[model samples]
Target: MSVKPGAADTSAAVTTASWLPLIVVVLTQIQASFAVNALTVSMAGITTDLDTPATSVGTAITAGTFAMAAFILLGAKIGARYGTRLVFQIAVAIHGLAMAAVALSQSPAMLFVAQAASGAVIALIAPALTVFIATNFSGDQQAKAIGYLAAAIPAAGVLALLIAGSFATTIGWRYSFALVVALAVVNLVLSFRVKPVPPQKDITIDWAGAAIAAVAVILLSFGFSGLNSWGVILATDAAPFSVIGVSPAAILIVLGTICAQGFFQWTRSRKAQNKPQLFNLDVLKTGAERATTICMATMMFVGTAANFLIPLYMQIIQGRSSLQTSFSIIPYTLSIFIASTVVARLYKTYSPRLIARAGFVVVAAGLILLAFTIRGDWHQIFVVIGLITLGLGQGAIVALVFNTLLTAAPKELAGDVGAWRGLVHNMSGSVGIAVASVFAVGILGTLVSSQLIDNPTIPASLKVESGINLDQVNFVPNDQLVVTLENTSATQAQIDEAIRINTEARLRALRTSLLVLAGLSLLAIIPAGRMPNEVPALEEPQPTKGKK
Candidate 1:
């Protein structure tokens, strides 16, 4: 296969490009997104059908994200060796097959397998996509192309929600994944129209660096994921084992940080030897690039955390249906799509640091507003307003940071940008969901005891007699909660009072969690200001041979 002509001429490539290939790349993003989002709407269905706990579904999500994050760098190297377009096509095919498997999954274990398979395929797609875009377009055209793809990402999630809502009612949740397969097939056919991208035979995978990066990211993700089940500070009863009653989650994070440092050292050594690096360490050498990277991860973390928390509160706590969850999120998702599509026009009008700092402010403001407005009813207008604010900010940040990183490096290092982005995105998303979920749960547990102690309806004698375990507090629907109270020796008035206490505590926990996240978002403004103030030069700024 031959690479299309004038691939090195970014400006010329943009002027002469066809839109079909770009559309194909965007479709690939939608395909992968559909697979990732299938579980969000089907959480209750899967948990019920497989007779498994909710944690099992979270485990599947984590497994998939972890697999993708761990293997992405190697996937980029492989893509370079074999040709990006070919690797992308093959990955799409595998992703389709994985989606089909998910459709027929009969157990939680099988579901995890399906998710992991899809995840591994997604790792390859990242690098391939980066190379494809780099080879095809540049300058403002590249920014617009990336913006459209980013917009499509949320559209995919919206589509997944609708598919699940429609099919889960008529047939079952299994049909939801079947829709993912259908999209993947359409995308696969369109991808063949993309021009050939040839292999970079000189590039090779570094197995040692790969191992270190993989293990480090996996451990960091695992640590975060464990917080909900294994306890935040100490080993909970769910934990299989512990070291001095300390949380295994904490231990893993410490180990992961050390490994990350080792990875950097190894990359430096590889560079000094004149070997190509797994990640483009050259790009990361600057303070601006590093800040941009952190801001990118932080933006994703907020979005992921908010998404997880919202769906959970609606579907699990309020006992609302999947369709209700979809409807509730419509404003936010739509706002994001609109913002992502339109914000590319602002590139020339504003500096990156200014745009990024403003984005963080908008997001933080949204979080605070939401914190103050949440009620048992999940009010429509206020929630919509708050989410729209958050979405507008999120969309701008994602688009700007993406263009910034890609522009900072040479076109040939597009795969490097892609691989690192995949790692950061998946890792941050997993950690965000895990941290928010467990942190809220921990806060709820603490508040439940205090609430029971303060409630006038529950006398000290009744607290001992009812045998209610405040330490094991968790959010459940009112109906399930009634069943739980039935097992305890309590009068009707006392039961109602206890349920009210639990509900109030849960609401309080949500508020507190949002405030914490908002504070974190506010903290990010400092680094957002450190991002490069202008677009980088198009000329190759990488180190020359033997420079290290």
Candidate 2:
């Protein structure tokens, strides 16, 4: 009754041939994982070269995330029908070509188009990679493979930072995207070990459900993406349109929620009619799975926020290079890789809920520490200690939650699990980055306005004539702020006052953002507690006696 089509799930982990396919699947995952992190580190260079605001680059990133979250279910259908290996092969080729086009794009709009194209193809690559592993490995081997797959994310991110940093410094940021071309080549060559699963010809694809979900995800993502730019509550001048003076961002969010509910209702209706459903609702039927999903989303929310804010602060605000950002993150990234790999050993002893709660607690403590420590000093010993602590927690929770979700489902539902994983994780990451920007900028604007109004040294006339618009403030180095003030008819005294205020304001924004992120981390402990007290024990596969 399990929905595996065409290909047979391997027996006893295939001690010989399964190794190759496992490696291939992990490579496919790493290739897809490289996309966003590379873009994140290169954001400043892109914004500068394209002559656009910071929000423009942020929107492009969010648009790609939206495309991936919206189309991921349809991608699952494609993978299930056309087969994992072929879908992966073709998807990676398209993804690489699109990224190369992204490198060539001379404007923000063109970059958005290219990244969106790549996100659509990545949706296919996401689910197919999971399915490939399930079909080729089982038991102990499957468990080990899943750990590698989980670790591949941070591993890819680390590599992306290094490569993007190098390219960003010397050849130009455009050349950084060329790295994906290399990934595509390796993925294509190694993907042969993964067998194709036959399409379920009888299962009718649910186009209506897909449309509803797409509308829900895009609206929600776009709405969140503009929270800072378009205003959080009331409409700002950036509002494209508003209803009754309310922010379009809030309105779109409400509409998106309604559409999301509609998706669930329609899926239920399909099930009642005994028609095919787009996603396997059965995967979410258990309490453990639902809790795991919540924990996963929350982790990504904080994790992605950190990823975005750190690079924004280092490269844009501090005038550091992308290479500096990479080295700064090495402690965190390496800890993630190491912890994720090691936590699999502890699952049999410590309960899932226990380990997960511990991770969140550590993350919350670390964030709180950063809130107190970050005062224009990212490389301080205390700051590095906090980051390492957070990384250890992040690494463990991800591995624990991901493995829990995988084991909670039957092998036949691997594609469903993978698709759902992509949707929640990427969607949560987009939301995280958006929320971070919103809080940091919104707080900065308020703090800056109050401080400016109260300052004794800067006259109101001089402040007004400075041509500095806090409402549309972009992250720039203090030096750039001085350069930007060239248009102003302000005196040297007023300019020094402006620089001092902006500098203090920047640190305030960074610290407050960390406070909010810490709050979110503490709140996640609820779901972490809801995860299964312990994972069910499956018999570990015995090694074939004659196998090497």
Candidate 3:
């Protein structure tokens, strides 16, 4: 039986009342999506205000992502037992309160705690929304509905960044959290329309699996998050004011791996005893399922890394205002929407594999172009390359991952698979941002050490005003400090001169990261080639006996 009670009836028409519920679900989903953007925007603000290191701020994001992934199965169980409508209400409420607290937080610890609560709430809401859609609509309607609904995430991201930049500039970053509270209010009011599903009687909740998964995800995410820290980047040489410690990240990674293996064993043991397991091992053994999961993770890792790094480069290095940087990325945001809409149409006529491959090729070609053409004289070339390639890749990624994952999974296991898909996508995004930040930091440090320019004296007032330690400023290394100085109230002549030198090094770092992404993208080509010309897995729903 499908998880949702009435979702598999393809021949039935949606009632007028049904539309309101669907709209409510979409609105609720947008709150979590808004968090994705809010977190990214606030990364800089938190680091600046709390006197926390940039890498530490970055880690908090990864921690939240880890929490979200680890708790998704638990969220699914909550939905199955307590029902979707109630679970969504609780999720929405918890998330809103957390956002409010985050806005008030004065320290990194407080921010991390707030993020953890928000992550838990996100896990509860995301998968339940998917199940609600699946159980409500079936057949082609289901596919089309999900495609449009899924687009809300990126759309919310764009909206959040736009609002955050403007509000932060005028009223301060705290006011940006007020935006989420307002959205939550709308979501709460609209949630009245979400019709309740009857709770399942035989549903099994796997507390053991949930605990293990949480530990594993937190450990793994923490490890990856540490990649952005100085401890890992410069292990041997102690630079000025650099963080010194054993590899806390590495230890967490090892612990996470162990937890994962243990969790798998526990699930298998439950199945062996003829008890219900949280996940169906049999469903995951298929090649298509495995391939689809891998592809989703890879795509998210690359795409998210690019998104995080590009904004940092523009706002921090290029001395663009946050608003200007947001506008610069407007090309990326619009390209995703435009290409996704067009590709949805094209997928009906052409093999998705072929279309997806074309997108990958365009992305690789564009990145390669940027690598070679990045110079002061050729800045426009980089913009053009980013626009064309990023558009193609974003469109292709959404269609390929969403469709393929859904098509490959068994109909009965759709909710479980959807939960896993969301988990993978978010986890990869977290890691991608972490890994990319690490490389960026390392590159900046190297640039600083080369001593190609006259190093400016560390501003005493600036450190005091920002409430950060002088040692933290010293740890910035040469290259990044130059870029930071260029963006500040420095003389225009000095800023221009710093820009010339900093641009060259920044281009080098950006190109190297893009090359790595290009290589990861090539892995998708083979998997895409193997996809069936037609999606045979998705058949018309069998008619219910009474209806016929």
On lDDT, the candidate that comes out on top is 1
**TM-score of every candidate relative to the true structure:** 0.90, 0.87, 0.79
Tell me the tens digit of each residue's lDDT in model 1 across 276-380.
778769667789889999999999998899888877778866778767878888889988898888877776666778888998899888888888888877775
Clashes of each: 0, 0, 3
Candidate 1 regions exceeding 4 Å error are: 1-16, 43-58, 106-109, 454-456, 537-548
How do the residues 106-208 of candidate 2 rate in per-residue lDDT, one tens digit apiece?
Answer: 8888998998898888888888877876677655466667778888998988888888766776788887787777777887887764566766666678999
lDDT of 2: 0.80
Per-model CA lDDT versus the true structure: 0.82, 0.80, 0.67
- In angstroms, the error of model 1 at 149 is 1.6
Worst 10 residues of 1 by lDDT: 1-10
- The window of 10 residues in a row where model 2 has the poorest summed lDDT is 1-10
lDDT of 3 by residue, 470-547 (tens): 222222223565566655556656545545645656666776777777777776777766544554334554555565
Top candidate by TM-score: 1
Order candidates by TM-score, high to low: 1, 2, 3
